[model samples]
Target chain A: MNPPEISAEILIVDDEEQIRRLLRGTLTAAGYRVREAGDGQSGLDEVAAKPPAAVILDLGLPDAPGLEVLQRLREWSEVPVMILSVRAQEQDKIALLDAGANDYLTKPFGGGELLARLRVLLRRPPGPVETGVVQFGTVTVDMSRRVVTKDGRDVLLTAREYALLRLLVAHRNRVITHRQILRELWGPKSEEQTHYVRVYMSRLREKLEDQPHQPRFLVTETGSGYRLDVG
Target chain B: MENTERLRHPGWGYLTALVAVSAATGIGYLIRPWSDYWAVAVIYLFAIVLLGLRLRQGPILFAATLCALTWDFLFFPPLYTFVVTRVEDWMMLGLFFVIALVTGRLTGRIRAQEQAERARAQRATALYELTRVLASAQSADEVLRNAAGQGAALFGARLAVLTAESEQPGRLVLHPSAALALTLVEQQTAWEFFSGRARSSRFAPPAAAGGRAYFTLAVAGRVLGVMVVQPAPGAGLSPAQQELLDAFSTQIALALEHERLRAEHEAARVQAASDRLHRTLLDSVSHELKTPLAVIAAATESLGATVAPADRPLVQEIHVAAERLRGVVVNLLDTTRLESGGLHAQLDWCDVSDLVNAALKIVGDAQLGRTIHLRLPAGLPLVRCDFDLIQQAVANLVHNACRHTPAGVEITVAAGTDEAAGRLWLAVADDGSGLREEQRARLFERFFRGDPGRAGGLGLGLSIARGFAEAHGGTLVAENQPGGGARFVLSLPLQHHEQVPAE
Candidate 1:
């Protein structure tokens, strides 16, 4: 498959030569302007010179720790920085993300996942969009009217279910932590009520999904939260 | 104390002798009319015996001579004169002197021998006590302080013990808490002794560079440190005292060596543990990383949609392989995090059906051609657990079964609460080969594969699955299905919840 027609330059900062080459081939094939830096210093220098539209930085760099570079960059630039984190970096990824990194992809990532996350980062920062009908897996949720239909048939849902579905649809591509979902649905005091979210999500899946057992749209991100896969 | 020796010496003895002789003569002269010359003579003789018992030979002789002269001159025909007129009186005086001399000499020798024996016993006891103290010391500093105090008391000297600091690597340190501390210069002397730059015999004092004396603390020819002492001026240790000091030094050296060996052993143990952890990571990462890499390598060589119409299969293989590799990596990372400690679980009151269904979907691709059955009862009370961890564990179990079971065999997944046990369990059973006794015993051990010949996986799945189960106050067990085949069960303690009202 050809890369998306994105003309914006993406800088990859990493120590692993093979990984840099793999990503370069993958990104170039996907129709994006790509730049490479071998170490943290080189990456910083390149960013200063070119000021790329986006940066994909490895958390473990050779010259300086990738986190140090990220912090330095965050001091000046708010350009979307997508980190390439490896396994066991759960804490570091969360910290980096909270510290202004736009997104992250674990090592040995599928080309499909990388492009998908890159697209999310490349898109302009999300703003509150007007309610509209959204279709996913034969289920159409008409948000303006707060109604849901599966396979052209009206599906019954409770008031809470509609609210839950609306929240997930709004942040469809990005993962919403369980605590965040609980707080949103059950109010601030209901942050500890994670099971409430799980029960409601199961009910919603049953009502809207053809195979509730095999979830295609409302997916659980293990050890994190949940993601709504729209595509 | 100087006069404590037999009063047979000249100084005090002569005074005592003069007093006895004069008193006896005055009494004899006053009572001379009450008796013959013999009566007065006997009184003077009695004075000689009293002086002989208390004084040495010189004083006794003076007393006997004075008694004889006084008895002859004063009690015989002539009085107040040195001349003795009677031979019998002279004979009597000589006989008394001989008897006095023999008794005093024999008794004095016995008293001197007893004093020497007592002193020897006291030295032996001091050495014994020092050995006891060193044996009980746990640290090198403790040994030094205790030894210094004991040595000072035993040898009548001010003592100091200095040890070489491990951090400073050859420089000596005097424990501030030690009983008798040495100057920094003195400690330098000790460091030189320990490092063998200064020569000193075991008990012999080191080079007389200063007023203080130094002895090396050595065991088996390995010098540990030194003890510096300043005995009372001119009151040097006897040969026996020197030997005892050497024994004390050796005892202290042995104790220090033991403490050092114990410390080294503890450090070696820590080093070994970290080494094993690193090796495990290296072995697992290299093997696991190469697997997906090999798959990606083969799939990319077939260049999807670029070379042939069969590009679809290669692309599908690539994605599947990539996802599988992702699972392997995630599992490895989770295991490392969990083992290294900080596996905080995010718990939710979850129905077992979610866990079973989620695990089934993830492991579905590995089923090849096997038929699966789900026997999870409806409305089972929710368990408080980390949903992701439990899901991963169940997925691992199903994956494990898929690999072991042959195609077309029935694989069963069942979940229910064991009320008697107050625990909830999710068990996966397969109609494949039943596990051997030995295999079942080590099934959950990390990197343990029942059949080493089988390809794929680092055999960490089952162990990690069990690890997750145990983390949630649960246990994972594999049993041979009684009828036949293998069964793996994950049992977690049930968390009582207020059931949500049904719609």
Candidate 2:
């Protein structure tokens, strides 16, 4: 999943000067080539002139709203974005994640936590790969054979259950909103039926995890969506 | 007064008729020497016709009779004789009397019609003036003043207006324009009508009930208030006048209702604008206060790794202080939101296990190597709640447990459901010394730090947890476990259960 070790660049788009300095210190200390943009227009210009490996975008910008910049950038770029935001703006976080943002960290976050989440965001491969088999904890899923085994024993799964598991596996380590789940599984008309995801998730946890109540691999983001942290 | 009472006294009409006939006799006598007897009769007829133009039926009839008698006695042939000598003279005298009666009757009818037309015009003018005045009034108070003035003049009465008080709608108070000097008994009667104990006396006969009548002013089934009018003694209203008063009451009611709606709308608009301003201010405060503390905390951590051994502890101290300040800021924001009625639970289907795990992770650093026991039973059904809020509440409980207990102590977290009550509960129990009596009394109070000497947090955790719990229609309670530690149990209701669609 690691890209070539030639030039791994990260672009930071934030209005606050001190925040930009702080982020630069953190990134450069971690041995990443860092680039900066003070406003949304400049940020877009910087990204278009020379694309970066990833972008750490802030939700608050002076020239235009961060959401608008994100929309404009997403039209032509597939660079992974990690949102930086304050805790008061919880209502908009879900929309950002659903709008192709890979992950997010609320303000006042610890330096170590930010780096850990950033590593996960950058570790993803740029293009889709066909993984014939995947494993987490004691459960093993073979995509080509359509078989799931736990501790060398066959585990029966319905056709719909297998489809649900494949969707999560495809977006593993990234947060996927309930709207995306419902639309992928039951068409767009079923967005209101969020209980469908809840029921299926519990069933999968019960079948695969050692303790279904405290799931390790399948994690819930609470108010946002779900994340499969296979790492 | 004379015109109104004219029909009551007919004797005065007869007296006037006698005087007029005597004058006519004198005129006829003077002309007798030069004219025929028929001409003398015609002069008397002329006098009766003039009286008819100015008098009613009774007076004109009297004048007609007087003319016939006077003409025969004073002007007929045979010099002041009562009898006529020839049949032709008798016939001529009879014809003159009949013609006088007919002419007088026709003229009297015309005079009565003219008087009726004038009365109608006066009523129309009075109503039009009242309507014009009421329409120009700007407020409810103005409406009351104008209505009272015009009503008293139009109906010849004293008027008082009573309206429901704006703040206390149950009771009614007199408006400033109440012109009627009401006695204690009359005021009590008005109150009775306002309370619906006594019905409105609309359409009652004029001057009924001691010369006072009450009319309720209402619009669209809502009673505005009552209007009481006391007419002058013995000057009661006619049915037509009563109808006009009804029209006035309707107009007054409409104006009052319009004013009330406008005031209410304006109040709502002002409140909405204030709420918006409050929200913007809070957002700015939260952003400004938390950003620098975040920088301090992160910067201090980075400085610690690279600093010399002697300076490492100093950097750590700064980090810890910044972290504590950050905690206070977060608590303050949560408290503000809770107090301002802005914390609404966005409920959705959530697994209790997930919430517990998320909470533990939030307070992970504070665990301090303590053993956490998870007793979440298998197959615990999902409950509906705001995932973020419930997780925060659980995290607060765990953090509270961690701070109160010594390092390496055990904390037990358990979960279960009561199917009969349809509730699922999660409890966090710490093996520290149980809470003291005084601490237990004010455990959930904001800023009530137990044992302030060992403080790390601003004691806002329990209150915020309770606030979040209540927001989800749930409850959080604290108690010392029987095994000698404090336990906080958060109980939440399972909102709904949907059948899983098979695929």
On lDDT, the candidate that comes out on top is 2
Instruction: Give one digit per residue, the lDDT tens place, for model 2 in A57-151.
Output: 98778898778888899999999898887763435777787777777888887777777777777775523424577778778888778888989
TM-score of each: 0.55, 0.80
Pull out the clashing pairs in model 1: A3-A30, B8-B55, B8-B56
Q: For model 1 chain B, give the 10-residue run with minimal summed lDDT.
A: B1-10
lDDT, candidate 1, B1-503, per-residue tens: 32245334447778888888899988987888877878876887777766655566788877877777777777776666767546776677777677667756764675567656766786778877877887788787787778778866765666766666568675766655455557677676667766777764555563453366667877777776776666655556656666767677677778889999999999999877976786567545744584346336433643563656766686768656766776677677767856775466766676576677767766756777788888866556678987778888998988888887777788888888998899999999998988999999999888898889977777899999988988999999988888999999899998786654343
Error of model 1, residue B209, in angstroms: 54
- List interface RMSDs for the candidates, in order: 5.3, 2.1
Worst 10 residues of 1 chain A by lDDT: A85-94
Expressed as tens digits, the lDDT of each residue in B203-235 for candidate 2 is: 334335446777778888787887887776666
Interface RMSD value for candidate 1, one decimal?
A: 5.3
